[model samples]
Target chain A: MNEEIVRLEDAWVHFDGVSVLEEVDLSINQYDFLGIIGPNGGGKTTLLKVILGLLKPSRGKVTVFGHTPEKGRKFVGYVPQYSLFDRDFPVSIWDVVLMGRLEHKKRFKRFSEEDKKLAYDALETVEMLDFKDAQIGKLSGGQQQRVFIARALVAEPKLLLLDEPMASVDSPMQTELYELFEKLRQRMAIVLVSHDISAVSIYVDKIACLNRRLFYHDSKELTAEDLEATYQCPVEIIAHGVPHRVLKEHK
Target chain B: MIEILQYEFMRNALIAALLASIACGIIGVYVVVKRIVFISGGIAHAAFGGIGLGYFLGVNPVLGVIPFSIAAALSMGIIGRRTKIPEDTAIGILWVMGMALGVIFVALSPGYAPELFGYLFGSILTVPTSDIILMLSLNAAIIAVVFSLHREFQAISFDEEYATTIGLPTERLYLLLLCLIALTVVLLIRVVGVILVIALLTIPAAISRQFTHRLSSMMFLSVFLCAILTICGLWLSYAFDLPSGATIVLVSGTAFILSTVSKSIHISVFSKSI
Candidate 1:
């Protein structure tokens, strides 16, 4: 085993006496690009929250890098869904990205040159270097998501979790984002919760179908039978490389 | 003016203005940025219960208000986070209940207390030396906390969910921020009174935010604006024999309106020229 980075054993989660996740067991290796796909109200987002230590599982255990989820949070970076930011807030993209360095520095100490360089480097990775001085709210939806990714990358974490990173983006931007994710996959383990199942299936190393339980699939050899079983509905799996599509078969 | 300074009360009032302006400016930045102006107002009004309790128990009003205000702040944070009730509704309920409790306590107290009026409408001219010292110390503490947690506070304000995933204890930070707000409200109650403290806390910061993009610059500009307004209001009150709290609020309110008007004009003219 290539040193599992994340291990969840029989993880169970309940909200308001209703089980959101039941007996979910998963293990992610280092540098694994994992895609979690399901319909709305499925437990995909909840699973990411559990891995990020934002929500504790009701039963079972979750370990990341041989430590508890809470202790391992410093090694995890997160990009949340679209936020409703006030347009009048007076903060620049540079200031927002530098906030990622707070956990590494002392409370009273000023940020060092190393921290500034890291923030700039992260922004450059997302191709947002020119807009570093711009106010965050002035950016478009795609640009704001990129800036959020930059903020997460500034922390230099081993694992990155993204919740619906491409929901509001246009088609070209979505393609560009997937390309960026391809480049990011080389250095960090990525767990993305996306509604675009066919598009993500082309790039992800593995896929997990979550709708109250785990339905694992190997992306390299995904079959129509697996698709139907995972979705609990008849699905015709068409074999095209990029921008793949899934159609339901009529009886 | 020199003769006014010769009086102990005038000197104390000046010191109160200096300290309270700095404290309010710093806390005001967070209040404005967080969009919690009404919540801070609710806290200030709720602090009246503390004052009434102090009078009823024959204790220092400042000491008495601390616990009551902190309790109210905690409840605000808890109910606002955990319940489906809108935050504004909760704030309204707490604000009215606090004042009613204060009135009931005062009416039922052993003897009629005349000092309650000063607490209600403010008496800058009656500020004592000890209260001035307390205000100065509180201002220092508020400045220290804000500066030390500048980055974390920014992160939390921007995206609290992302902050938590990156290992920042956002809930604890939020609670700490509410506590700081409560402390600032208590420190400022003497200068502007509870009724007018929210104006002093929000107006200068809101105006300063229009001219700056950095948090530190906003803080500096707000403090300078507040200090100047406090001095100008005091002078006006002294010259015209007006209520100091109302004068101070009017001064800050005018500044807010002027800033808004200038901002609109600048945008329109620039757009036309372009």
Candidate 2:
């Protein structure tokens, strides 16, 4: 029932001699929903990129399904952070979502009927099937996230990686997405990086606190000391700033 | 217009316009969407070096542009992506360096470059059969490359990082796209001249973008628009005794202004069906 999907060993990343990740080691298994919580600029996005092989770590090793990051990334679906691209880009939701099946298809070959069906079903799963013909840029922010999520799901990935998935989504939409993730986790391992601790505590089976380093546990409860170490701040401020339910278990 | 078809120069000019339009119509979409107009302009200006190299070597300058501009394109693509030097800054330097080299190469040649102005501002009416053949070949190459690899091009233009994550060799594809742009610049040189090549490259795609949401439609419409505008400009220049390249650019400019103004006034009369 338990098989390892991702493993990072003694990973250290430095950008121009400035350390972004320090001695971060993590292991994710099948059916695991691991949430990484951290402060702004806490290297959460960097960690995800390293896993995707987009950013090569300065030191240490990372393996996905026991293969190199680049080769194994075909089985990993990624939903990047909210809104880094041009909103005025001239691409339709259907075309953008269909790109998810590209790695599965041969170079220069057309998308097959099954590929279209999977993309359609993925859009339907995210309730964005109605906007298939609409330009991706014409949609609102939350709508765009759903489209990207649908793209991630269309590939039938063994591992799903999302960065800042909840950043700009509204409250109701956030709950919908969390529920969507809950359903998705049974089929694939899910790893989401967010600064929000409350949702992680509530939804994820395991939680990790990351600043420059990583500290995680099997249970959702993160000790106050872990939050302090990650945030480089006091527990009192976290209790005040975060939802009361988040720190209740810690206290 | 019917009588003009009998004249070989007129016929050649018209064919050149169609060929040039096809090249721009396809490559221009990537240029506009990727917002790499400056680098394109650099590639165009850098072809002047190739033009100069042709004069100095006593070969057809258009032929010289093939290798020269490809080199320019590869350099711009690689240096911009691989090195820390800012892309625009690199383009600026290369753009002027090529132009300077062109001047020097022509100066060193034995005789006066009689048709240099034609290459500068364009005299499409004087386009020879040899150059037309070259243009035809270049256009074919451009079409073949784009026809097969446009999906990858679209992927990079829409989101380069995402393209990389999905395991596309984004850097290599980008360089190939630049090479296509270089080839397009070669075809366009005869129709619009080096000075005005960027206009022909941009205006058609920019106009077509207003009315379409899909990439394929945008490309198709863009090619159609390029052909119409270039022919109109050529006719106007022929009838009124004006410089053909400048005339074509101005006509495209006017069409753009008109299209934008009409759309803004709630005329949305033309449905975006395409």
Candidate 3:
């Protein structure tokens, strides 16, 4: 079996005693492409934070690469949900991508030639090398998303956690991005989180639904019960390509 | 103008302004980009408490500011992050409280407070050589810290959650930035006074933001702009017999308005040409 990249055993999180993530269990293996879809405010970000060890779980065990989340997070690349909160923050695309190399960089030392080479490769992979010196905010929303993906890829991480990468991107770039993710999953595990269930369902190998509680299936298909329980309401899911139903109308 | 250099007080004032520029240029970029102008202002005013403590204790008020402002920075940083109170509310509370404490401390002192007006309105001409030495060292320390941690600072200022995912200690880095602001308040207390420190801390960086896409270059431009403006303000004050602090802030504020206006005009013209 491939290396276990992430494992959660009944993890729970509460902010001010309001349960955000309730008793969740999940696992991901190397090179696994998992998609998590849910409504907004449904603990998606909180779960990502828990895995990154930015927030501690109130109860239960969560580990990445078998190490505690804090120590293990160095091997993860995170593309945050917000494209760039402060677009006019005066950072160039090159600077944004190079931030991925910061974990490998030592104090009082400059980014090595190899680090720069990796960033160069990452930008090239995303076809954004031409705009390396452009200010990050000046780009269109699709271009910004690609640059963020490049930033995440620069670190050569074992696991890439993309929170809503398609949230702001238009449909055409969405296909291009998903195709890129397919190529990327050959080397590393990719976990794509979003509210658009059909888009995530099309490209990923496995699917999970998360509200306060997480309903995960080891395979790609999700049962109707899973959809209703996760959304807490009836769901009608129409996929992007050829006519398909993620959730058929329940009797 | 060149003849004024021969006067020791004038020379000292220029030196103080130059020293103040270093802090303003480097830390000011973060202040502007992070939108923490009010927090820096809060730190500046809360420093009045320390000035009062110095008066009550009969020591150098600048020395009193060092500890008092650091304490205030840490308190505000902690409470604002950890508690339920909105950050601006926290700042507003501490801002007036510091001034109130300073007022009471001065009122309770044994004799009439003579240097009080200078602390409030700035008296750059009267800055002791001792204060210059202090500003020089403080400038050195601020530079060293910024040089070492600039990468982390850039990361947090850009995207704090991502910085934390990479294990850069974002909270500590943020608090350290505030502490740097506190130290800067000390440096500027002798230049612009507490009330006007925000002007020097923000205007130069805001103007520099218009011209640069890189953080390092932004700092360089901001420092240059601030030094020139403060000197121009100093000269105007010296020639016209005006208040130095208000003059300095007005000079920078005018430049900020001009740069912003020019930028808008340039954009509109460029779009039309295109």
Candidate maximizing TM-score? 3
Cα TM-score per model: 0.89, 0.95, 0.96
Score residue A207 of candidate 1 by CA lDDT. Answer: 76
The ten-residue window of minimal lDDT in model 2 chain A covers: A242-251
Deviation of model 3 at A81, angstroms = 0.6
lDDT of 3 by residue, A1-251 (tens): 67888999999999999999999999999999999988889999889999999999999999998899999988788888865579998999998998888878886678889889998999999899999999998998878888888888888889999999888788898899998998889889999999877668567878899998998877777888888888889876655564434553556
Question: After TM-score superposition, what is the CA distance of residue A24 in candidate 1 from its true location, in Å?
Answer: 2.9
The alpha-carbon RMSD values of the candidates against the true structure, listed in the order shown, are 3.2, 2.9, 1.9
Cα lDDT tens digits, model 1, A53-155, are: 8899999999988899889988888888775566678899998888888887676688999999999999999999999999888888888889888888988
True contacts kept of each: 0.82, 0.73, 0.76
Better of 1 and 2 by DockQ: 2
Model with the higher DockQ, candidate 1 or 3: 3
Candidate 3 residue-wise lDDT at B203: 95
Cα lDDT tens digits, model 2, B1-274, are 8898899999999999998999999999999999999999999999999999999999999989999999999999899999999989999999999999999999999989998988888879998998888888888899888887778888899889998998989999999999999999999998888889999889999988989888899899999999999999999998999999999999999999999998876555555433
Q: Which stretches of candidate 2 lie over 4 Å from their true place?
A: A199-201, A235-251, B267-274
Quote the lDDT for B210 in model 1: 93
Ordering by lDDT: 3, 2, 1
